[model samples]
Target chain A: MGAPFNYDVLDLTDEQVDAEVRVFGALTAAVRRLNEATLRTTVDHATVEEVRRQVEELTARLEKSMIPDNFGVSFTKGGRIRGYGNAVVGIRNPNAVPLTVVQDKVNGRASAEFELNALHEGPPGQVHGGVVALVLDQVFGEAAAAGGSPGMTGTLTLRYRLNTPLGPCSAEAWVDRRDGIKTIVKGELRRADGTVTVTAEGIFILPRWAREEIAKNGGTPPQFE
Target chain B: MGAPFNYDVLDLTDEQVDAEVRVFGALTAAVRRLNEATLRTTVDHATVEEVRRQVEELTARLEKSMIPDNFGVSFTKGGRIRGYGNAVVGIRNPNAVPLTVVQDKVNGRASAEFELNALHEGPPGQVHGGVVALVLDQVFGEAAAAGGSPGMTGTLTLRYRLNTPLGPCSAEAWVDRRDGIKTIVKGELRRADGTVTVTAEGIFILPRWAREEIAKNGGTPPQFE
Candidate 1:
């Protein structure tokens, strides 16, 4: 059987991919600003209403022509990924926490430095526990990939040790070990000054389809989360 | 000894609260539309840049005068809640999954009917696993609150039995049992057709601060996640 979904490995030039990254990246940043302003604004009702109308008009202009559905992860002939709809690190997703993970393939590690804001609050001024899990899941997946063995998250466990303040934060993860098809990942969420607030462990495994594909092609599958 | 955060019990009348809800809810919906368009649109680079400028201008209008930080959960004299910054079910939060959970206060049950679109995608057409955890965490927190034992999420575990497609979905959670200071909530994520795709159990606990407040003031803390 084939993989559960269709992923197109397209042929595109580096120049084209670079331009798309630049253009869409800027739009995503702008939308993120809009998201933050939407929460903190103390503007009056009339201003809010007027701004809503303007926002709708701009959205319509962009939506004139669009993809049929979500931006499925696509691979370029050059091996660049266009997983632009990812919730945690999608470049085009304004809902993301604006995380950019750096992979250390030699060390089987992944790390990110990001900021959380008013929109990410859970208990008063603290980051939402769910958001913390979301970011860690991504970092863990990247760590598994950095180790050259990747799969979907089968089980993720988190222990909340301390409250993470809503501001500058960092996350680091590394591949702990592997057992057959399963890769174990360990990681933590930290404050800017480097105090650990949460710790996590995740089990990642190749789904049946990926395993079957490997049996047939003897090729490793792309990293997925 | 204070509740770890300042919560103002305001004197806003019903009319004022209702109006704020209506106005802010509309803005949140509009921003959601913009978020989707940002990912799906196929407009040209010039058009994308133009839209970004327009979006930035409109956002500035909203940000002219704003709250210093997050919209912390507050209670009115009439008991209306102002938790507009919440990540899961916040009406004023565009990044929320747009969920409206129905609480069966009598039976310790809570459920929500919402939609997950392109922005929530992870594996091709399926919803992100972290997003699933995010939604279940909120519903489970609500279930604990409905049981008359509000608390924060101590730990959450999710097992992915199947992939949840991106579209209309439902979630239901109930208080499975309770121990001293802990509530165990069980729930599942289902397709619109009612097939369970993800099963979850969460442990909710009254934190030290909340416990101290309950001891001194002889009152239960509000539900937090």
Candidate 2:
């Protein structure tokens, strides 16, 4: 809303996006491995300090090479950001479950598939309840966006039907209704057995500034596909 | 009702926990800085590769010193895990917003304070809606636990009153009611000005196995103080 939500499509070709994806994807995997290492490492005090020193040196070297302030969002027409820099579905985020989302514009639906590991646990053997909510919010938000009514989340309600085990899972969402600039979306997270683990409903609203921008821009909604 | 929820407290001295917190806290901060660098770096492809190689080498070295399989939860008799290795409030987790939670045992209430950074952003300038849900779940779960009835989240409902800007925020939760083993908790996320950004109500259920474990262990509810 403040800066038109940065909807301008970046001028990047498919090949370029693919190349960036490959590189960033690898980097993301490395981070994931590093997280696991952090969780499972039990080195002695001296070794831990040694490792820290090495990492700090590397961090210092990288600090010298930086972009201007502000990490701009990269929006491509009919494409997701292939770089791992994306917060929701970015492969580079060790915290991310790295859902691969797909949108069906004709059906006003969105879905994603991912697997949670020990890294995402809450109560021992189960996936963290907060992680389930996070995934549902992302999927439902995508559904709202796919319905040609991109908006910010106004409310999200989740009912955990079962303890989502720490393993493979899938999620889907669809627009249930739309009222003016507000869209309601329904979504769920399921285990590999197709048993629903969590169900969610969310209301998304186009902010006043965004609504005005759309009106000024000839009433064109942001495209998800 | 699967495996008994791991509520067993570990026998660690305060000094030991403090040492772990210091070490892991430094590591977590470094990883957070690295994440920012990864997002904002504009170095040449070769340079990026070189940096990746260095990280990969460090990761490999750490991998050689593994600490068994699971990352055990650090639970002391009367203390929260100060180490950042905890999934929710752990400062060691670069992905975590690292909420500092406090529970009023007498009041049956829980409160958390945190600051969401660019790493937790979803909208152009707003905190990720999912992150809101995640924090609410944690706060509410803590509230339920603080109410002398520790349990797992069964449902969490959230109403976003506004687009929570990415910055300093706080949340609080209190027990609303209790039904058998289920506890209902109400909570809200607020800005420094006391503007409520999101409100939540969650149902937390003490599973059958956990109930039995409590009964067998003399019916003492897990302490949250």
Candidate 3:
């Protein structure tokens, strides 16, 4: 209602930006706490119900500041956040399905872990194969991003090593090499016992559009941390 | 119940194989008809509604053969007729998601088309990006499989060029090359106006498991054509 929408420019009020950052930090902390509980506790039916209620409350609060259009990530004065309101990787929402990315910089390797609850399961007792791909894609993309080149997904191939269990699980990805426009990254998912569940490798391309966007914004390209 | 359950393979008399074959043939023919109609028509609300009714009726008949477990594709008796029954490419049921793939062998190119009906859509109005990836992966994998190797998805990467229209759309995939264990394939989706919507590429691997499975089954891999 404030202004007509145009793709040319992204406008965010200072208050909106502050609110988004606060919400994102809260969400990150909440997910971490929930994940910790899931990993540490027995997590019976009652616990699951309690967790669900907490998630619902979080969802309600996040809905208030929801932007009508998909919001892109921004580096504010502080570099604490990225993609605050993006559809897949948005940080400022209860529904933002976040993936925890851990990097082994010395080894040039990286891994990620997340517990998908009822919100993520696709098959009856197994995680949806597509969901597995979604997580793998993000994890692998981030792994490549961490490897001095952040590229968009060009092609990803996954092998279903086994039917992934729907409960607590972990995933890992690491960089293979850089070949021209392609950044090859390898990734895998596993149960707590370390059974190789799904193995994947991806070729991410430095997209022309994203590069143009970076240039237009007067920003240097993102580099490996 | 005529035999406890309708399509229990254990209960199916030898004679029922012929009946099953006939029924399957009819279903295939019906799917072909639907495909033809889809190509010929604009597929407006009235058209979709009409088609939905027909789909419902056909689905009911197909559901009559409700086996206890999922019906995986099968071939026996010297491949007289391959059971595309459980193929994820058929149009009749929700399970296969009914992909329409067309290969231009003369040009060594292929394209696939399908609709994201009420069942498949995750986000509002826009087709789920993951669903788009699923169809692309299947078609791209099949394209690689067409080129002698018969590989599985080793990696797939997609760039969401645009929010794919919820209604009628098309997908295309082509074999790029083979490098050792990786068969490189490229693919895309487009709207009716021929605008390139989504672009994808995948590295398909000729997994050791599939090779062994083919050898155990004996003879050439079942011809996809």
Most lDDT-accurate candidate? 1
Worst window of 10 by summed lDDT in candidate 3 chain B = B1-10
Predicted candidate 1 versus true structure: per-residue lDDT over A1-225, tens digit per residue: 124356787899989999999999999999999998998899999999999999999989989989987887888899888898899889999898878999999998999999998888777677888888888888988899898887777887777777787889999999999999889999999999999988988887767754674566555576753
Best by TM-score: 1
Q: Measured by TM-score, how close is model 2 to the native structure?
A: 0.87
Report the poorest 10 consecutive residues by lDDT, candidate 1 chain B: B216-225
The per-candidate TM-score of the B chain, in the order shown, comes to 0.93, 0.83, 0.66
For A154-208, candidate 3 gives per-residue lDDT tens digits of 6666777655655678888888888998888887999867889888777777667
Estimate, for each residue in B1-225, the C-alpha lDDT of model 3 and write its tens digit.
Answer: 021111112334445556544444343333332322222222233433443444333334333434433232334443432323322353222134567677666544667766644323322334445556756766775677666555556666677665554567788888898899788888788876678878877777755655565576554444343
Q: Least lDDT summed over 10 consecutive residues: which range in candidate 2 chain B?
A: B1-10
lDDT-better candidate, 2 vs 3:
2
What DockQ do the predictions score, one after another?
0.61, 0.48, 0.05
lDDT of 2 by residue, B175-196 (tens): 9998887798998999867899
TM-score of each: 0.94, 0.87, 0.48
Off by over 4 Å in 3: A1-68, A87-89, A223-225, B1-187, B191-194, B197-225
